[model samples]
Target: MAEKHFKYVIVGGGVAAGYAAREFSKLGVNPGELAIISKESVAPYERPALSKGYLFPEGSARLPGFHVCVGSGGERLLPEWYTDKGISLILSTEIVKADLASKTLTSAADETFKYETLIIATGSTVFKLSDFGVEGADAKNIFYLREIDDADKLVEAIKEKRNGKAVVVGGGYIGLELSAALRINNFDVSMVFPEPWCMPRLFTAGIAAFYEDFYTNKGVNIIKGTVASGFGTNANGEVTDVKLKDGRVLDADIVVVGVGAKPLTTLFKGQLEEDKGGIKTDSSFKTSIPDVYAVGDVATFPLKLYNDIRRVEHVDHARKSAEQAVKAIIASEQGQSIEEYDYLPYFYSRAFDLSWQFYGDNVGDCIIFGDCSPASATHKFGAYWVKDGKVVGAFLESGSPEENQAIAKVARVQPPAGSLDQLLNEGLAFASKI
Candidate 1:
């Protein structure tokens, strides 16, 4: 028998879909009115902790779903949220295809769901160079840690190869955090960078250079100005070396390609119009296909600062975009005009020896705080007060012990020139003025 048509159908089980379901329920959308189909058996939870818990020592595995604020602890869960709302959870299923003409979605189990509105929060996957045919991968142990399985593989390798050596190929958040985790697991870690400094796309040289020394001091073999071409394996068919672009190599038991992630919209297969190969959506989060909307890493929605250039594969983007998608869906249902998603973008990572954060408008003109030290063997701590004349855009960190209260001024918007230094003398109350 065919299930009743839902007022709305949301695909994907990540934060975007979860947030949407919560809002739909809050708006008094009938308990039985919504159908949320998710691929993850587990409800939406934190994504960063995947690497953290997987890398935990034998006795340090964190209690799952437990949370504490100040001193209180409990699990903030979705099953209860879903139950109270009468949200049908079709878990462990995939929405294989949909008929835009017929307005129906066929699931893997051959179950069918028709909807008045649809959301495509399918998210994205890590981009592997094999898809691009880039050479360098041989019998080496190359890893791309994105999903739970990928992190599980890393954990297994860590248990078997404690004190082993691993090379991290990218300098992005995932790469940095994974490398740090490996080190904490007692693995010898060598971090290779595509740029002279760290997080070049996100930080000023001042802040990037600081982290260079910090990681090195924390037992990370820093390799800047080097590019990994591929990986090499030994006679046992395991990675033993990382082949470099200029014919050099780094000894390795595992090669982690933190190269970055791309939208998982590949399977969308032209069913949705794309901008730069990612599904495109308007401010309302509506895609070119009627009743279908996209969010999370799969979306190339407008960045009010980046001249509307859409980007993929960032956690901040996922959380904020998901929230925006829920708002847009609710507004539309109430016959209200949809508002575009615009906000100060933020993201962060907890790696070995430091907790780092990036907040605010990153691109555009800006002034920097701290010094861009010369790259050599000696390391220094650095911070960047990246800013445009009009507003402060970013705060770049280099494992500094400073209170960093100054960065808060720029967090809302850029502080004034010399304003940071003045705050160093003043305090958090100092206005970040132009």
Candidate 2:
């Protein structure tokens, strides 16, 4: 087998790997000392755009436009950036076997690489209907958006099936964003989920109500309390319809599934300590194995704010955790100490003209406030989650820059809420006062 060696190796070229590379550059990286291995042909770009701007019927986002760090208001790191920094990017190379004992990774092509330190940011894989034994789930034109190739396939389908009937499976961020994208492209879009409301994991019924009504107004159908049980295909094996658990069938020229994601931890399952289906790591993102760190969706680290261990799949956390892990690695190498990671959970989604931001733990009693009416001019609305008489979480839609920051502060501080009614009445003002 061909052999190579590096001081550091990042095993995934996604948001986390990109940010970690940037951090290493900032801290100082010697040429030929660092390398990134990825199965993708291109360097890391904004994955979220695959469902949003990349699907736009016009002027869609493309590579170099939404590269890593750009989402966080930092400079875009193009492939040339890696070349300029002398950081090797081994794209389109899948490391099939990893031997932690020898700190070696073997790619499918029989190429072997040895690393002094390793950062596993393999990210998450999209859950598929086929995984659940749904018949006809592998039919053509049925796409799952996780990588650029998947997004490219979906875009091609959108163009080939213009004004076609599209069925979106799942009600989380992917379903909502893709439904909106299909609608904008003149496709008859319908969303299906096994919940009463969309984004059940984060949005309360009231928040979901606003979005569902808004989507309906935009001519997108919302089918809740049911799921796509199977699929129907034409003679050519292209998806033509979706069969729901409720014994209902809907015509579908194209299907998009985003039921959920599973962390890509199978390779290290027996080698690393895991929690909640992810590789367990400390605040420094150091895995159980020495010199092995895990970040992004694959790392379930401590959430200091909640005093709990959680794995955050959002891009914000992906970037922050990668930076933190790289920083920790640098500190350890220099025999210096750094502060433990203290993260406040954050999640957000955008579709059509609506955008919502949430911070802190979602646990506790929720109180909806502000003008959440769909017909409202400003379309401003928010919700607060109180736990043990303290405001532990906050969510706001159509909030201004300052307003969103204020709500995040309220979640971090978790001020004692005297009365639910009083807090509801105060609304955004409550966060502003804090």
Candidate 3:
């Protein structure tokens, strides 16, 4: 009933939190009014290049060593960035509960920070394979490659395995990327994918074949359609074999488990409305509790590309969605109208010698156009023009001059009638057929 005092109290100082705060400041709000809480001990940076150094091994200064980072663009925070912005950066802090009804965030230290509005950008953690009860699953040799800590473990394990053999489970983006890095380190690497094809959800069968052959050519053993029931270890507590559902065993000294990651929204249980591993938000990124909004991998909202359902996970997804969250906070402050946030989902991965780029299609209905075959190296580029049949979703590789433009416009919205047909020409364009 009274006028709320605080402007914003953002939890989890990752990309979303920092970007939301920067946006808030652009709206003329002072930094002293906002609280940035992060478990990482510095301001948020970027992570675009962390894997590069670990993959390259020549030890370039551009790629230093770090773990558990909430940074950006290969660099951590300068400390002065927050101070200059007048933001109260709380590091090594964790928010245990959201007292949404009281408009407060309770920390583990028995402190409550009152907020007129709150943003939760708590990201995600790697999914561990230990649940399946692989023998020696919790052993020191097995690691989930998610945070910087995982990367460090991977680096050490790869070095140790250089004298022996290493295995990676699940052939999704992370697994594939790590596979390439391990191979680069001269470790005899083997990848175990549950699915018959690589990245079955993201790429078409053709694209998958291209990558399969690519990784195989690099001397990495590729095993498909194998569901690993668990792991095996020697008496020394070192991983020695990986047991498969199909009854095959792999010998290895180091194991990198990259099954997947789930949103770290579990901490908000009972404190916020959510389905799955993310908090719910509306068009304005506002939670059911007034004055509280959610963003990043921890938040969910109807994304048009996802058929207007709350979707989570991805770097660009967080940035674009949080942009809307920031705008929502400012609009609510000024009594201005707010617009819904929707984006075409996109993701990428590097495996062996191939780079994979993807966009849209959470449920997989789409049309492919290009030399998407593994037998031919001609079409390093692949494109997809998808529609709900009601609306189109387009995705493409970074190349393909004309196709890139078409996919871009189609993602914003389908072109004014007939354009979809032109994109779907059944006749061959190179044959001079009309």
Q: Write the per-residue lDDT of candidate 2 for residues 333-385, one digit (tens) a residue.
A: 99997899999888888888988899988888999999988888889999999
TM-score of each: 0.83, 0.99, 0.84
Tell me how candidate 1 scores on lDDT.
Answer: 0.67
Worst lDDT 10-window in candidate 3: 60-69
lDDT of 3: 0.67
lDDT of 3 at 389: 46
For residues 200-308, what per-residue lDDT tens digits would candidate 1 score against the true structure? 8776665665667667767888777878876666678787888777777888877788776766674577577889768888866778886688887788777774456
- Candidate 3, TM-score vs. the true structure? 0.84
**Superior by lDDT: candidate 2 or candidate 3:** 2
Error of 1 at 98 (Å): 3.3
Candidate 2: worst-modelled 10 consecutive residues by lDDT:
344-353
In candidate 2, which residue pairs get closer than 3 Å at backbone N, Cα or C atoms, i.e. clash? none
Error of 3 at 145 (Å): 2.1
Question: Taking the tens digit of each residue's C-alpha lDDT, what string does model 3 give over 382-410?
Answer: 54444444324444443454544444555
TM value for model 1: 0.83
Q: Candidate 1: RMSD over Cα atoms?
A: 4.5
Model 2 scores a TM of: 0.99
